[model samples]
Target: MKKAFFIVSVLFYVNSYSQSESKKAKILEMISLTGVDKIGVQMMDNIMNSFRNRDNSIPDDFWIEVKKEVNSEELINLYVPIYDKYYTEEDLENLVKFYKSPTGKKVTSIMPQMMNESMEIGKKWGQELAQKVIQKLENRK
Candidate 1:
């Protein structure tokens, strides 16, 4: 009888402890703990700002041409609502936590610039490789 009573008591304690947790709050806590969403948001902001600052290096007329070809406004109209479905309260919390971390801050600050620079280098190398391959083919012909 004492063993049975002790078993029941343990079960009750476990049930109560678990019952006290709110699923929504638990999910939010998990998202804040993960911190990936924050990094992604920071990256997107950096990339958007980078494009916005194109200066005369990329002619604004090209943008006007592109906008005329593809109505970016219409595309965004169909696209923007997905954020409500995909970016939850949990994700926002996680993003906030990541934005506050030292490594996360460093990545948010410089990674986009590094990526842009590397892409330019990759394009340069690809052009060189294509020229070499073309030369080789012409020599053999």
Candidate 2:
């Protein structure tokens, strides 16, 4: 609950500061600056596809388990620099624009909930497909 509220609060704050450019254009500029146009899309797509698994065999009590390993603030601090290196103001402006817009606002509002659903969907389908591929190879052998 607190996490979701914080995300929304930050999004709102960002949006309040940036609205001069269209979000799409800003996003495009970011892709260009990041030099990801060549195959970044494909790479990210592949990564997302790989996130799915059939058994949904994610760590049980995942949040609690993660909390046990390290403090959230410390973990966030570790990733901040890596993220900051890639995230330019233009990228942020675009994100803020999305966060402010009607569709973006709605998406952001449900972002966490949506991710949980997506993970389950991805895992269930992904595992099944992978299993079939393995079975096919075993049969051929």
The alpha-carbon lDDT assigned to residue 36 of candidate 1 equals 34
Instruction: Give the total clashing residue pairs for model 1.
Output: 1
- Residue 39's lDDT within candidate 1 is 47
Question: Candidate 1, 124: how far from true, in Å?
Answer: 1.6
Instruction: Put down candidate 2 lDDT per residue, 26-111, tens digits, no spaces.
Output: 55543444333534444444544455343356654653454366443443344445545676656667665666678765765576
Best by lDDT: 1
Per-prediction TM-score, please? 0.37, 0.42
RMSD of 1: 11.8
How well is each residue in 1-141 modelled by candidate 1, as lDDT tens digits? 999999999999988666434334444443344443354445555655578696648876765564456443443334334533466555656665776689767766786689899999999999999999999999999
lDDT of 2: 0.59
Which lDDT values do the candidates have, in the order given?
0.61, 0.59
Q: What is the lDDT, from 0 to 100, of the residue 68 in candidate 1?
A: 53
Q: Give the Cα error of residue 49 in candidate 1, in Å.
A: 15
Model 2 stretches astray by more than 4 angstroms:
1-72
